[model samples]
Target: MECKATWRRWLLAALMAVSIVSYARPPASAGSDIADAAQAIHTHAGAHRLILLGELHGTREIPELVRLLATRYAAQGPVLLALEMPHREQASLNAYLSSNGDAHARATLRARALWQRADTDHDGRRSEEMLELIEAMRVLRGQGRDVAMLAYDTAADAPRNDANARDRFMAEVVRAAHGALPRGRLLVLGGNVHAMLERPGYAPPQMPVPMGAYLRDLQPVSVRIGAAAGEFWACRQPRPCGALAVDGSPGHTGPQPMPYTFGVMLERMSVARLIGRADDAENRRAVGP
Candidate 1:
């Protein structure tokens, strides 16, 4: 449960990535997959304080897996869900969760103009799969479960000017969440890069440290699980490559080229309803199964 060894951590992440990517089906294989994954998560999460789950935004499996973990852990004690969503949405989420209306949450997203990313790239800002996750969360809370969810991103009052600044701020927010609930287990979820134990910085002139690395530095008890399925978009872009493009040069994106399905990356929960019919069709054709 306690992943003190570097190799053990890597092995866990690799197994999750492999299983999540290769395993297929709707209701059958998911049981074993979820059971195996849930057991791993429970082992670490039960003993440790923080469990970071790496997500490939638009995929359906990752968030369902997260819900599986939350549902599994809710009976034992307090389970706090730390989301990568903007901290600004905290109040709206609270209101939406407290009420039965799903419409308000959708409206809040529209008011923020956080809907579609097609203006920059083909990546969806929101996805239906993610909405399902949000609905699941709301339902869990409504069922009188001890599952609490919130956005642990950025310093509530600070002005983030760069990516690193945002990472640090988000790290602080996570640490704050931990401090707030010392008795509960924290389930942190975010994109692959943000959740990596030894994550490198985003873009050039950035440090090699990831947000997870910062949290690990603060609390070494954290366990990070990375999951991805098939090929998906790598980041936000104006044009659709429908695949990966790596910078082979020194101090760049990668050591080699990796394939992808999205022109954009990391769609938010609202994306399921935020995007237009045309965009959804394009996304489904490009990546969705």
Candidate 2:
């Protein structure tokens, strides 16, 4: 049964299980890359007048990038920092900032809201790690930019099993929010998973097809930023990583090259595992002593 709840409310509910650090991007540095990313995004915003910079959820550099851009873009107009975190965190989010407490506490309260309010199915239960991203969202919101949750989440029980639901959900938010945002620019922070073209493996094969192809169809302009080629892992774990290391986890890492699709990489991993299992039953065998 498809969830009867509205899309915005559903997004808030289902988003509770999200974790920011799982993708594990490298740390960003204080200079160069951060400035470059900021400058690039800034330039894009200035030129296109609207650009959504897709980011890995919980990447350490993302906050800094957001911090830089939010402040830089502050004068651009109402800079709506659209977060994938839930709406339940709003009150606590504001409180944490108002308390003038430390980063840990602020992060804690934000997570608490996500865990408590992730009952997207209206089942009256929270989700695991929903708080982490919520904490990140809180961090971004505390910055005092004109932020809002895009609320482009589909219900857990949606009729469509694919990410198109998510894409359409986001598109609707952009369209609706765009209506009131004159001279306003939207900066979406979300998992690249939902930002790509939903296909057979990544998305359910049976979902309704949209007119145009790819998630890019939903947005007019997008800018993907990260480390240069063969240098994504510039930072290491256990702190003191990257240019934007507030608490030391390296910034963006991986395939090294920026402007590539990590989401697609994840899908590739899924495919590889699937193929491995199909080719060799022993690979799928249960682990044993």
Candidate 3:
């Protein structure tokens, strides 16, 4: 009995140590508030309701958060996932999901090909695609709930280019799908930048404002918004290693912010300053013309 008590004490200490180490490591931003937000929205939104989960593309924790939240609410109803990916790839993803899918293959499909096909504006690229979608599908399937994909983007270059058309498309898609499923739940996973009140800068100047706001007005059921933003810290490793301030900005030195979901204003402004410096140098070097 003495030996058993000693072993239990040692085991408890080890477990506590492991937890402290885990918290010390970065990307642990899955706060209780975020989970509570998910639960609150889940409780309010009806089976036919729409919920948006926005993320700063490069943040790895966001997708994991999505998976966690989705699993937490899997018992609600059939989740119909609407993505920022192109409509063309939905069939491919559907086919892949229907097959005896491997994790590696699903990852490749979600990461590699989907964005390449989805980017209507060649200038706009996704830094880190929502690789969580595939994983979420796997989780839902495991729980015996149906998961479907809907691509909510058009071939147009900018949001302004297809404002009415896109709105109509969303309405029609929701109407059609909701009619069929007994308890259809709509969930849109997109870059936090795009689903904002105004379009991001890389998009055409004429891009309309209030894309997400307008959608909220249309839905009969309540809507919920949850977001996660990435702050750049001094990462010793190739991938980001730690978190900085709660709401800090990324760097804009020799390393350009990869054109992905949304361009950080601070990074962009810094790059402009560097470019001005370079131009000034060239002017000084130039001889009388």
Candidate 4:
């Protein structure tokens, strides 16, 4: 049976698991080479329903690249900016974006946030990055883009406190988000772990396979990309600046971090023109049906 979109009331609560770090990405199982991750995705031509940008948070480059890709893709068809936000704030998030007033939006967003708490919990001053991401989506909306928000997370009545519980909740959220989209149009920004393909060959297991694995079960062709380079600050781990191993473990050795916008990495990666089709002209609204 196909699961449909559904919403339930949720109370605002808990600390966001916003652990920003440098993510490491191994080569995918198969795909044509492209200049950048965006170009790589464009090469797929929206053939897949879910495209996961597995990112290690705390860098400007990844989000900028995501904005560019999301903007370009929106012209193709309906695109959902399915963020890793707690599902409890769906109403507040919708209201924040829909409001034209800056003051009102800020107040509302601060009230029920997905990342930073409204008060002085953990650097409440820096919700700007997340808000900016929201604005990027809003800008596309103003220009008549088929963009929407999916606060897909563990909407637990009480704060979750276990690895198994968190992983299970995230899988459920990704499945729900995937089911809500049309066949091939979900652009997800998430932890690299969630974007990995399941490998049953391993002895025990991949130790808590992420949401992307669950999503892949539903949409086998989902694309995965990682936004990590060597030399990054780890907010939640002992290795503050180090290389990330293939399985998300941190190490002391790796190549230097690229300073530019995805720098020269696009050479090895797929790089395609921003516009996928001629019909993606600027005047076209292409809102979701």
TM-score of each: 0.65, 0.50, 0.52, 0.62
- Which digits, one per residue and each the tens of the lDDT, describe model 4 over residues 1-289? 1123343222111111121222122211222222255564566544766666655543334555667678778888777776766666666666654555255565566545344322212311123445566766666666666677777665535454555566566667665656656443777776655555553344245256555555555653334343223322123334342223322222211222211011113212211111122332331232111
How does model 1 fare in lDDT?
A: 0.51
How much is the lDDT of residue 226 in candidate 4?
39
Score candidate 4 by TM-score against the native. Answer: 0.62
For candidate 1, write residues 1-289 as lDDT tens digits: 1112432232222112101111122221344555565665576444676766655455455566777777777677777787776665566555555555345454564455344445334343255555556656667665666566666565334664565776765666676667666575788877656665564434345443467767765453333333222333445445552333322112221111211111111111112222433556675454334
- Candidate 2 lDDT for residue 149: 38
- What is the C-alpha lDDT profile of model 3 across 1-289, one tens digit per residue? 1133433332222112101101111223455645554555455544435555444433434454555556655566566666565554555555544544454454456454434422122222232314334545644564466565655554334355455556444434433444444564666665454444334467666454434544545453322132333342222334443333324332211112222212112211001101122243453233111
- Each model's lDDT comes to 0.51, 0.40, 0.42, 0.47
Task: Evaluate model 3: give its TM-score.
Answer: 0.52
- In terms of lDDT, the poorest run of 10 residues in model 4 is 10-19
Candidate with best TM-score: 1
Estimate the overall C-alpha local distance difference test score of candidate 4.
0.47
> How close to the true structure is residue 234 of candidate 3, measured as C-alpha lDDT?
22
Q: Distance from true position, residue 137, model 4, in Å? A: 0.6
Candidates sorted by lDDT, descending order? 1, 4, 3, 2
Using TM-score, rank the candidates from best to worst.
1, 4, 3, 2
Give candidate 4 misplaced runs (Cα > 4 Å): 1-35, 111-127, 155-162, 199-206, 220-233, 237-289
